[model samples]
Structure formats: C-alpha cells, structure tokens
Target chain A: MRLINHIPGRPAALLLAALPFIMIFVAYSIASDIRLTANPQDKLLPAPTTIVETAERLFTVPDKRSKEILLWNDTFASLARLLGGVTISAMLSLALGLAIGLLPYARSLFSGFIAVLSMVPPLALLPILFIVFGLGEVSKVVLIVIGITPFMTRDLAQRVMEIPKEQIVKAQTLGASSWVIALRVALPQILPRLISNVRLSLGSAWLFLIAAEAVASNVGLGYRIFLVRRYLAMDVILTYVIWITVLAFVIDWLLKSLSRRAFPWMEANL
Target chain B: MSFVSVTNVWQRYGNRSILERVNVAVDEAEFISIVGASGCGKSTFLRMLLAEERPHKGDISIEGGETAVEPNRERGVVFQKYSVFPHLTVRENLIAAESFDKPFGRLRGTARKQAEQRADTMLERIGLNHVAQQYPASLSGGMQQRLAIGQAMTAKPRILLLDEPFGALDPGTRLQMHDFLLELRDETNMTVFMVTHDLDEAFKLGDRVLVFDKPRWDPQDPGLFGATITYDFDARNKGMPFQDILDQYPSLSLG
Candidate 1:
C-alpha cells in the first residue's frame, strides 16, 4: 500500500505517539549509564532515577536556610508575576487594540507608534526596565508585559479590523454610538480572539518571566535553573525544567477550556 | 419633496469612480429593487442610502430631514452575511436592536422584561421561536435571514436597506424568505431598497426595479467612467410571472 493510503487506527496512533517519548527515555538512560561508568563523579546527565528522587525532595522538603519548600516557592513566585503581567497586558491590549482598530484618530496616532514599539527587541529594554522599575517583582513582571503586550495588541487590533464592515454598519444603524459599538458590538466579538492571542503569548510570557528571574531575582523557576548551573546539578535542573513544562501545559489547557466554555459560538471559527 | 431623495450624487474611490450622476426619489412606502451586473455600484448606492458611506458630491435625505451624515435608527439594514450579531442569541438580537437606542445601549429591570416580551413576539413572527435561545451560528441560512429581517424590523425604521439579503440562500429557501419578507412588508409602511443580481427577484418583490449600468464604457480604462441607473421599471401592476420584462431583456437571466 502507498504511504498516503495508510491511516492509523486508534491503537496504532497511540503507539506511534508514544514511540518518540520511549526512544528519548531509553537513549537518555543508556547515555547516562555510560557517562557514569566513565566517571562516577560526573554530575552532568545523572541517571533518570536521580532526577526523579531530586524532584521529590525539591517538591516535598523544606529548605535548610528558609522553611519554605524551594520548588513551590519558585513556582508560586513565577506564577504570581506571570499572572500579574499577563492580566495587565490583556486589559491594556484590549483597550488599545479596540481604539486602534475602530477609531480613526486612535489608529492614526498609536498604530505607527505601536508598530515601531513591536519591532524593538523587548530583551534590549530589560536593563532599562531594571533601572526604572528596579530589580524587584515589578521589573520582572514589567518585562513580561513589555515582551508580550505589543504582539497581543497587534493581533487583537487585526482581529477587530477583520470584523465584517456589515456588522459595524448594522450596529450604527441600530443607533449605537462609537462607545456603544465598542462595548456591545466590538468587545464581545474580539474577546474570543483575545483569549486565543493570550494562549499563543503564554510561551513568550513564560520566557520573559524566566529571563527576568534568571538575571536578577532570588526565587523563580528560571532562577533555580540558572542558579544550580555552578554546582553542575543536572538532576535539580531537569526536575525544575520538567515542572515548568508541566505548568505551561496546564496553563495552555486551562485557557483552551475557558475559550471553549465562554465563547462556544466561536468554535467553528477558532 | 419625496420621502427619500438622492440628487446629483457622485461616488468615487480616489481616481476610480464607482457611481456618478445618480438621482432617484421615492415615496415613503416604496419597495425599490436595485438590479445590476456585478460591480455596477448598486451596493454603493444602497450604502449611500443607509448613510454608511457618503457620496463625494450631492445629497441624500430621508423624511425631508437634513442630508444624512451617518447611519442612525432612521434607516435599518441587512446584508447577505453578518447581518445578525453572532454573539447574541436570536431573541437577544431583537432585544439588542431596540436596546441600542438608549445612550448606554442597555435595558434595565422592568424595561428588560418588556424588551424580552417584545423579542419573543418578534421571534414568533420570524418563525424562530423554537430556536430563540440559540445563537445565529446554529440557524440555517433562510432562518437566519428571517431573523435578520426581524431584527431590522424591531427598530421600526421607516427605511430598510438590504444588500443582497437572500442571495446566499437555496432556491426553495429563497422563495420562503420572499414570502416572509413580503408578509412583513404588508404589515408596515417600511420603505425598502434591496440590491440584487437576480432580475426576477428584483421584479418579484419590488414596486419599481432600478437597474444600475454604465451608460458610457471606456475600453482602455474601465475606471474612467462610473455606473448609474439606466432603467427604472415599474412592476407594481404585474403579478407572479415577470416574463414580459424578461422577454424584453434577454441578457438578464431568470435568476
């Protein structure tokens, strides 16, 4: 049979999906074992079991200096910053995006400025942010906001512009003023798009959060990952990396479910 | 003075002209069916009437009011697609039509109750009471068209502008919508201006059919000239079969 004609059944599909994961696990174990045999003191690719054990210790045990569990503290701190930055970005982008997309004056003024702003590499402003906002939670959170807000604003503005002219005209004929159209017509329609935009921006939000944490902060997933590099603690790093991936996956899943529940009408389009 | 008047109107987009020297006048309850070849500015004229866009020159006024600057509650409109708001339910769409009249675009407490009741009546009239709670996406093409018309009707505007409103429906569904539209039109003195490609439909539902075509065609440069109303046929006395008119214009197909 030709390759194109072959369609996998449920069991075959499940097996195919698991194959790469299984191969990676087996390869890592063999490589780690060989490295250990060559030099038992090697810390770089410690066995998978060592990583699992470290994860358990990090998750459940309290730190020696501080009573707080390191993993949970890092996760909580990172989450709080991510939430703060992303929330502020969403609100600001929605307002700015709607104005840019809907109003001529706002579009003429901000559209060009926003275009220039989006082109500037956000990481270049990290030092400036630190100097202005200081190296506290504010700087880190601001980095995330600065990193993702422009893109979200642009995406949302495009989505708003994509709304059929017919609908806008219809709304106007229904006696809606500009504010009413923005609130009643344009707002609800672009909300699902904003949710979709947020989902896509989560990865970048995480990246900015980690970068800010790594550069200056004491407690965060990124800080822990960067901090342990001096000790060659592969096991701790791997544990933190896996946990971060899990958190990102959970966040993406929650946003998907939220979009599904709230804007069921957008299913076909989304 | 006519109830709705368009005098010496000219529309152009930059160097390219779309409409020019368009003049028409209608009574309050006239059903003006506008038929034209594709890109003949029928829709543009309709948009001008709805005050969605303005002509480059001249004037359009309704109820002897000042020249319209923007779309208001005075003129309602429906398009073939995106006529109804997708986010709102069938009943809520009708309620929205009326509630949008308020400065804040809201109906509160007792007003909300009354609006909902009126919406229910509109739903019943549109034969969409079964799906009143459903969003526009769940509705069929014909049902959605009916809901769109019903939504436009709820505002009770003296003028209704339709841009190929039933152009997307199937043949059977199109006929059903026709009946529904005519029945609704009989109940009110609403003046309607509908743009359609189908000559038969233009004559079927319209008191007068206005044909938009370019009087002067420039072969080298199409944009050198614009289209205007070339023929105005009064189809009020003729009923059912529009064979006499179709027989006169062979280039115009049945649909």
Candidate 2:
C-alpha cells in the first residue's frame, strides 16, 4: 500500500523499465508524423522505416569508389583504434596505479602529477595532439588514451589503497618479497577493479574516439555520421548513433561478465 | 633462556604515548595471552613483536637474533579478520603460505605436489576440508580463523602472533577456536603471543596471561603517561586464582 513498502514484482519492474523507452519511441513517431505532414521533405526526424532501410543499405552495400561496405569498414577501423588505445591504457595504468598505491616514493612522485593531469580537460588537448601526432590513426588512438588513462589510473590507485593493512602485513610475514606482493597479492585483488575501470572509461574513450574521427578520420562511424550531416541525412546519422550505443552497451556488459567470471570473491564486494 | 625477549620497549604516536617501558620474557613453546581495556596498548605491543611497527625505544629479539626490522618468515601472524587471503581458495591459501618463500612465490613439479599434500593435511587438521575450494568470503567466521591459523602454521615459524584473532567471532565459535588453537599448539613448540580484550579467554588458553595497564596517569592529561605490563599471571599453574585477579582489575572486561 505504502510506496516504500510496495516493492514492484518482476513483471511490474520489467514494464517500468521499458516504459521510458516506449514513451521515447511514441514521442519520436508522433513528432516525425507532424513534421512530415507539414513538409514531406523534412530531414529533422526520419520515419522508423526510413532509418531501418538506411541501416540495411549501410550494412550490405559497398561504396562505389572503395568497393567496401562503408559501415563495416568504419566499424572495423573504430574498433581497432579503440582496442589499441584501451589495451595500452590498461597495462600502463595497472603498473602506475600499483606503484602509486604501494610504494611511498612512487606515490609522492606521481600522485600530484596524475591529479593535475586528470584535472586538465582531455578534449581541450585535441588540437595539440592532432598537431604533434598528425591527423593519422596515431592521433585518434592517442586522444582516447590521453582521455581515459588518468581517471582509470587514479581509480585503480584508490582501490589498491583500500586493500586492508592486515593483508599486506600477512603477505610480508609469509616471506613474500615486494615483487611477489605486487604480483601475487595486489594484482589478483585489483584485477576486478581494473576491468570495472575499463568499463567505466569506455564511454569517455568512445567520446574521444568519435571526436577524433569527426575532426580528421577518413574511415569511421563518426566520420560517416559527420560527413552525411551536410545533406541532413538524419536516417544515416540516427542509425550510426544507435549502433554506437549498442556497441558501448555490449562492451560494458562483456567486461562485467568477465570480471565476475575471473574474480568470484569480488561478487558481493564489488 | 628466554626464546623471546622485550626490554624497555616504548611506543608513541606523535604526542600520544601508546606504550612505555614494556618488558617481558617467554620460553620456547609458551603461549602468552595479552589482555587489557581498549586503548591500553596491548595491540601495539603485539605489532612490535610482529615487527609491523618498531617501538619508539628499546628492542625486541627472538632466539637471541638481532631485532627484526620488518616481518619475515621467522615469525607468523593472524589478525581477527583479513588474515586469510580472500582471493585464494582454502587449499591455495595454505599452499600460498609455504610457496611465498620460494623465489617466484610458487612451486612446481615435486615441490608443488608436496605443498598441495601439506595444504590438504592442514585443511583436514583445521576441519575445513569440506570447503577446500571455497574462497574466504564463503567461509564461516570460525572456519576462516582456523584457516588463518593453519596458513600461519604452514611456514613453521619460530613464533606466531595473533592480534585479537577471535575477537570478531561469536561466543560459541570463540570457544571452538580456543580448542582449535590449543590442539595446534600441542602439535608444535611454536612460541605464541596473542592479544585479546577477553580476560576469560586470556586465562583459558595462555600459559602466562600478561595484563597491560597504565601505572602512571595524570588527572589533567590522562594520556600524559602510557600503558605498561601491570600483571603477569602464571596461567600454566592451576593453583593461580582468577577470582582474585577479577577483584584486582575490575576495569578489564571478562568475555
């Protein structure tokens, strides 16, 4: 009866979850109908059928000049750069985070530097990066790395610091050296956090990736979306945007499941 | 000769003195139980012995060796919680104890098989064989503490330190842990120092129960002085009465 006491059942919960998405669809359909009625050639909001058809064509049809499916090519190029940047960031952050979290000397040296680096808006460095690394794949990948590394590193460092003092002392008494402690003790525990951090940063990585592509990339989902905007190809742009959202969601879900499978002990704690 | 010795040990944290002029001596295979009210420096003294933190003054040495600057394989320790590695399964936690001494913190070939056998033996001894593959999070409080003690013993250290190792357990589990600790002590002549706030637990398992209290305290600044060993009862002797100890130190809580 009371709102606080009445927890929704499974079906109710499902419907509640779907309600917002359904409402968004209804709103978009009505708005599109009204605009199309006023002007048959309106490009602001495409009909649902138009978007689907555009997506199908994008997926199946090869470009006339390149003889490649533009959509698949763009997806592959973006994925390659994203994975490259993320892998490098994860490896570097793990090492730097462990050092900053465990060693006093490393903490003093990097903690302040990382704090300042994280404070500097990563997007603002876009121009400098483009100039230094040039308008090639390197610049785009570097933008993603520069965008997400500091936050991920700081998050991992905090998680490492949260490890109980007793565990560290227990490891020492077990005759584990500093290196052993990092590899055996700290590394196993922080891995779940690293995966979660990677998941958290994927959004920002995509943001940086898209910005780079829109600005300078010849082949990417962002480049395609930005290139068709001149003719107000709303159907193509909408398809690409939906595809990007799905990709980001899949990545986050995959990382979550991987962490759960890898670190069963972290089930309740995480 | 004493197997473990502490002479004129003092500890401080900035302006607050936690321990001062603490002295004790224990023979090999003796179990030393420490008891006092909270903030009386019992845990600090145990930390000093574990070499987790050094005393501000004086020294503590074991087997006539030089004072340990940091924790080493020569000594083992168990805390009330966070003693067992949560990430490792019950069996791996025990094997990890011995394997940590290896160069790579691991074992292979025959050494690996032997470590696994020893770990299995420890698991049986600790009565945790049923959950050998389970992580520490899934284990009960008593079982976790048993696993912790078992892990500590896997190294066969000369001395074992327990800092309120059973303080977090329920009353029933705590009693079981007492029996478990005594059985392990019977198997080996490992000098043990355990700090607990429970006076009854102190007398039940300890060979000599050492009570920490402040002999000198200023009325204006109560912490002007620090705590030291006020009573060391010979618990191994059945003739020693605890009723009299209770009357003497009413401040200590009896668990």
Candidate 3:
C-alpha cells in the first residue's frame, strides 16, 4: 500500500510509453503505401511530401490567403460562442441538478419533466428554436443550452443520488444540517463524476454547436465548411474539420487535466 | 434521579413487537452495556435512546430538561459499521460537529477557534493526530473506527452511545479498541450506553450489564409479546472474577 501511493502518473506514463509504438505503426503504413503506389505521374493525388509541405506552409508562413482563412475571425467567433454556450449549460445543469437531486420534493416534482425533456433530441427542436429566437446568437446559444443541459442534469443528478447513504447519515449523526450535508458531504463525494460528465457534455455541446451553426449563419467554421462545399474545396473543409477536432481535443485535455489537479485523491484511486 | 430513563417502553415494527415492556435507567456518568442475541431488540433499544425511533406504548426522557429526544447535540452516537464520511479528513470529521451552529449556539470567531482547538486536543487523546489530514478511506479499519469515535466525542456530548462500535473489527483490533474506549471513559467519565452481542466485551467495559432475551409469544395473550430482562449484574464485582460470572451464566460464554 505504501509503494502504491508512490506510483503516481500511471495513466500519463502509460500513454507516454505507448506513443512511440503508435508513431512507428503510422510510419510503417505510410512508407508501405508510398512504395506500392509507384506511379510518379499521379496529378490528382498530392504526394505525402507535398501534403506535409502544404501543412508546414499553412502553419509557418504568414501571408498565404488559405492560411489567413484558417486563422480568421470566424474561427474565434465560433469558439467564443461555443465557450459561452458550454459555460451556461454547465452552470445551469449543475445548479438545477443539485436543487432537484438533493431535495426530495423537488426531485419528485421535476424528475418526470426532466425525463420527458431528455428524450426529445435538440436537433429536432432546431426548427422551433429558429422560429422563436430567429437566426442570431440567441437561437444558437439556446440550442446548445437546450441540447446539453438535460443530459448533464440527468447524469449529474443520478450521480449525486447514488452517493452512499452512509456518508450522508454519518454527517447527520455528527450534527451537520441538511445544507451542510448537501454542500460539503454530498457534493464532494460526487465531484469526480460531475467533472467527467462535464467533459462528456463539452463534447456533446461542440457536436451540437456545429449542427446549430450549419443553419442560418453567415460566419463560424460550420458556415465556412458549408460555403466551401459548393465549390468542391475539400481541402478547406478537411482543414476546418481537422481544426475543430484539434480544438475539441485540446479542450477535453484541459478539462481532464483540471480534474486531475483538483482531485489528487481521485487520481490516486484511478 | 436517573440521568437517562426508559419507562414501560414498547416498540413494535408493523405487526411484530421488537421490545416489549422494557424499562431501564442509567445514573450520571455510569457505563452500562446491553447484551442480547441477534434480532433481540438490543439495537432497537439503542435507537430509542438516540431518538431515531419512537416507542409505541411508553415514554423515554433524558434528565436534561428536554422531555423528548429531538436531535440534541447532548447525545453522541457511534455505529457498528464505522459511519465516518470518506470525503472528510480525520480532523474535518472532528470539526463536523461545529457545522451545526444552531446546536452549538452561533459559532463565530473565538468560539469557532476554541471548538477547533478542542477538536485537535481530542485527536491527540484518541491517538489519531498523525492521521489528522488523512481521509477516512485511506485509514485502516481500526484507525477509521477510532476516527469515528473521535468525531462523535468532539461535540462534548453529555452521554455517549456505542452501538457495537468495535463489532466489525477483528478480535485483536476489537480488544485494542475496547481498551482504548475503557481508558477514554475513565479519563472523561462521560456516561456511556453500549449495545453489543459480545458478552466478554460487556463484562470487560460495562459498569453494569443488562441482558435481553428473545421474546416469547403466548396464545392467551395473542397481542402481547413477552420479552424479559434476563439479568442485570454488577460489572464492578471485586471478589468474583468475570470467569466466575460466566460460569454461573454458562450461556454467556463466547464459545
């Protein structure tokens, strides 16, 4: 048990240890494909060297129009809206879930309503939101909130409810009041699950954001992809897709890192 | 006057009688242990004392002015399964009693500091000061049970109730905890009422032992379940050893 405590960073260490093997596999596949496709005069398909060069040029060079498009204000606009929507959803879900989950009467009253609400897909409600709020930030933000909150609320509430009754009873036996039991005891016990749910909802929110932005929007990466699709500019579409994937990856990584830092005890258990 | 009194208490569960016509009294600072077979209402009696359950046919009164037990800070309870919250550190568990400001009378500034200081002193007394910062999950079972004891005692309650606090531990740890509890009771002189199944434990720590027997049902009195107190013996006998007492009550032997 003493030695177990010293073996920190196991997950990160395992991932680090596996990275070289993954890189080797990818390199072997690329090398084999390059050797097999010996036709040097293939004009339609860019060589791996050219693709790498294009990627390097896009990242390193400052003046290219394609590079400018990649680093445009539209990207920031989309990111800002994504951040706003996710923040609102996270806060509202946690507050509402805690209220309903911890209070028995509230749970009885709202549980059915939340259950029914969760089954309705947000995409199906897109038309209704567009009609109510119209084509602007309001509808997009509302769509993301509506899309994410129910799932997060349900997940968080269930997690909160599943905390061992002994923990709460123990606190009560110590003379802790209802509020203290909820805030101090119950909340901390379910925090790991809460954070994991938030991470899950972040991804869901991003997926909803793209679908939300695809309709009635002149800006954002989604709109950019929609516009480039008409001209058959697969490169731009693929580039934005890659950018979105990378952005989501970074956000997910940051959230996980925050969870690890905030809860060293959870890290130890894991 | 008795420090704690239960008068003609009859507790029934739905259709079954758990404790029937039971009465007991404890003087101030007295250590009383109740031992009974499984499902023989020993735990039910403890619950009644803690006010977690109500009696069907009679009344229970604390000598302190309160007529009914109503979540008072004056009574502290330690459970069998070790009810310490896993999220809280040992010190936090001790100070948890401070969070109930209504019972403690508006803890603020100097009062809160004093309470915390007293908790630290209790940590030292329980020999858990080294694990003050450790959560209950990280502590060993014996350590966790000791922490539970410290947490329960931190409120400085007038009476301490132990519902088989050491019942879940192995024999060696159980004996160690029993000794620790005995030493603690000697130092504090706090009134204790422990409900246990271990007769030896009852003999070792209790100033007086109350033995409860299984209920007997009679056809003539169909509604009345007959339960009786088999014995109430002085645990502080000087001339007779505990083994001699066990010899007389052969049923009370551990084997």
Candidate 4:
C-alpha cells in the first residue's frame, strides 16, 4: 500500500494494485449470503471456501485426470486457434498495409474495398464464415483473422503514412532506390507503431476467439462456459473466465515487454 | 559552354508565378550565392536546377558532354533542413551515395573499400569523424548539417547546391560552418551554388552574388519575382575584396 503511494498519480497502477483486495472482499460478501439445504446429504449452497478448496484440489490432486483433461483440452485448443488466427492476421495485415501505404496505385485501388470491409464486424460475418469454412477450427480461426486484420491494417497504414516526408526525400536524394527507401526508412519508422497496434489487436483477437469458440465448438474454454451455463455451474464458469483473463493478461504483458525491448525509443514517446 | 547554364527559366505553382523568365550561368570551380527575401523564388530556382521542379518555360543544361538528363552523382545538394536520415549513422549516410553511380547496383570489395575510405576522409574533412557511427538525431543541428555536407561530398559531385544550409544554425555555429565551407571549397575546388537570406553569408562565401527582387510584371513595368543580375562581384577583385562589397551593402549586415 505504501509502495502504491510512491507511484504518484498513475490511475492504472492504483487500480491494478486494488484489484486483488476488491476481488477478495467481493468473494467474502458473496460467501456470507449463501443458504444451505435442509437435507444433510444434499448440499444446495457451496461456500466460497469450498469453491477455493475445490480449485486447490483440482490443481494438487494427481489422480484426477478427468479434471486435468477437462481443463487442459479446452485451454490448449483455444490457445492454438488464437495464436494461429492472430499470426495470420498480423502477417497479412502488415504486408497489405505497407504495400497500400507506400504505393499510390495500391492505395487508390484497395482503400475503398478495405474501408467497406472494415465497417463490417467480424461477428456479423460469423454465420457466413461458418457456412463457408464449416463448423470447425478453420471457420473459427478465419473469423478471428477477419475480425483483427482490418483494424490492424488501418492502424499500420496510418502509421506508415505518417512517416515524415523529409526522411523519404532525403533517402531518394542520397540515391536509395524506392525498395531500399521502403525497406530501410519506411519500415523502421512504422515498426514501433505497428508493434503497438499488434498489442492493441491482441485484446480484440482474444475477444473474437471467445465469441468464435462459443458457437459450434465442442472443445474450448468458450464451450466449457456454455456447457456450465446450461447446468448453472457458476463456479466452473467463473474459473474458466478467470483462466481466460490470466492468459490474456500474460500474453498482453509479453507483447508489451517485447515491444519495449525491441524498440527502446518508443518508451519516451508513449 | 558555361559549367551550369540556366536559360530563361520560368517556374510557377498553379497560376501563381514564382520565378519569371530567370536566367543565370555558373562557371567552373565558382561559388555562386543567391540572396533574396523568402518569397523571391530562390528555393524554386534551386529546385529547378536540381530537377526536382521543371521550369514552365526554358531549359537548364550542364556543360559536361552528357546528352540525356540523368540524376547524376555530378550534382550534390544540401537542403536548409539537415536531411540526414534519422535512423542511419553518418557512415551509412555517406555510403548510401554510392548507389547513385549505378541504379540498383551493389558496391562491393575494393570499390566498397574505396567508397568507405572516401567517406571516412570526407567525415574527417567535415570534422564529424568522431560522430561517424552516431545517428543524426543524437547530433547537434550544426553537426547534422555538416554530416549532410559530408554525405554529399562522398559522391564527389562536380557542383554542390546548398539551399540555405546553415539557416537553421545559431549565429556562432553559423560562422564556424561558414569557415569550414570556405576551407572545404579551397581544398576541393568544387563549384557551389548556395541560396541564403543572410547577406553576410552571401558576402563571405560567394564568388558571385545574385540578388532577387519581386518581379513587377505590369507589361508597362516588367519587374517580377524572377531574379535579375542586380549585383555580381568577383570575390577575387584586386582592390575590393568580398568584405568591402559586403560593407557597401549595409542592409546585408550579419546583425
């Protein structure tokens, strides 16, 4: 708490510092309000302590292969699809953005199409995608790719356009060919912003992943949530939700750390 | 043939005329300075010579027997703003000039060695040898401009075009740059065309000064933005040195 005071007025740091305590207080309040069943053998309400004990048992018990399989299967499946979709989106968007931004003809030709595509939300196209790619991994991954690429492309293209005209002019004056100028001057200048946009898209990509997995998926965190929701298993749903949050947090943190390490100059500007 | 001939050049932007039927000729190993107010088409004229802008009427020709208009290693230009690439070190900036020799061709082995050696020498000449490995952003404005000059000189161009190269520097550093440029000119004997608003800069470095005034295109009185040969002085005048000519024009004072 004293360390929190040393952070000056950073609201984000303060909020993060308060999160665990707030969650604990909420859990305590919810636990106190639970009602027990009249029948001794049949439990109607599970205590917050019982939920915690169950989670601990799930982790510590080596013999509980079923629980482990249930957790690992969905988690790994979701992660694999998320990674594949994001990777495809990132590569395609970056390449297309650079091309469009650098070349006037490409910009003129593709800009309108891209604008139209960007306006259509990926979720809106999910039904159509499902019809086309079928109710499998391909369809789910494609949906996520479609969701993320447009924003990424727009951000990356805008950053490329914002590269100072003087840099290009100077490069040309120094006898650098168009390709050299694009590769050396333009690419490096936009890299920091591109990395930033990639980090931003990761959140949206995860959101799309969950939404995609919720429909026609048998093995995923989203599927588990759906299954638990049918039976009103709020504890399992909460656990999976927590797991998703942690994974997203870790991924986002890693991306930001990588960005900082790769481009130290970006830190001061940000 | 004059070393560089700009004959009856007219530059315009849309309907507004900037340089109206201007003409000037530069000889071998001469340093010419164009001095004028901000809107008097000094930059436009430089752009015309650099082939960045085409004259609406008239032609520019170089005396070197080359017939076709090519982006030559023969004409090096230094802009008012230090146009050195922020991402590149001074050495990289210098090495980049070699690409102009043959479009899209690589410089390797002994040829690359020679270019590097030349770049190193030029870096030393510009007194930026210590900062050869440093990016332009890390250098002072004066140092960056000097690095730009070094980058230009690395290609060993026949004529150098400077568009108010020291305009952004502070007065003290401006004087230092002026002295270095003069010393460089003395050693290299390369022709230089500079545009400056500062009268002292024109007087100190120019072998001949061209003063531009707003052209009056009244048909009855045809003075326009095109610069006429208002005053041309040979810096090597026996009794009257450049300092004396500068003294004559009190309006061109450094202060």
| Chain A TM-score vs. truth, each candidate | 0.97, 0.98, 0.77, 0.84
Model 3 chain B weakest 10-residue run by lDDT: B98-107
Taking the candidates in order, what DockQ does each have?
Answer: 0.68, 0.69, 0.27, 0.29
How do these models rank on TM-score, best leading? Answer: 2, 1, 4, 3
**Which ranges in model 2 have alpha carbons more than 4 Å from their true place?**
B239-255
**TM-score: which candidate is best?**
2
lDDT of 1 by residue, A27-101 (tens): 999999999999998998999989989989999999999988999989999999999999999999999999999
**Model 4: runs farther than 4 Å from truth?**
A1-68, A264-267, B64-72, B99-118, B217-255
Give the per-residue lDDT digits (tens) of candidate 4, residues A100-132: 888889899887888889999789999999999
- In angstroms, how far off is A206's CA in candidate 1? 1.3
lDDT of 3 by residue, B1-255 (tens): 788887888888777777888888889888999998787788888777777777777777878454444445667888876477666678867777676534432367887788779878989998988988877777788888888788777777777888888888899999899889988888889999999888888988988899887557667754467355667878876315474777789898889
**Candidates' C-alpha lDDT:** 0.91, 0.91, 0.76, 0.76
Give the CA lDDT, 0 to 100, for residue B56 in model 1: 95
DockQ-based ranking: 2, 1, 4, 3
Judge candidate 3 against the unseen true structure and give its global Cα lDDT, from 0 to 1: 0.76
State, as a TM-score between 0 and 1, how close model 1 is to the true structure: 0.94
Our tally of clashes for model 2 stands at: 0
Residue B203: error of model 3 in Å?
A: 2.2
What TM-score, computed on C-alpha atoms, does each candidate reach?
0.94, 0.96, 0.80, 0.82
Best by DockQ: 2
Candidate 1 DockQ vs. native? 0.68
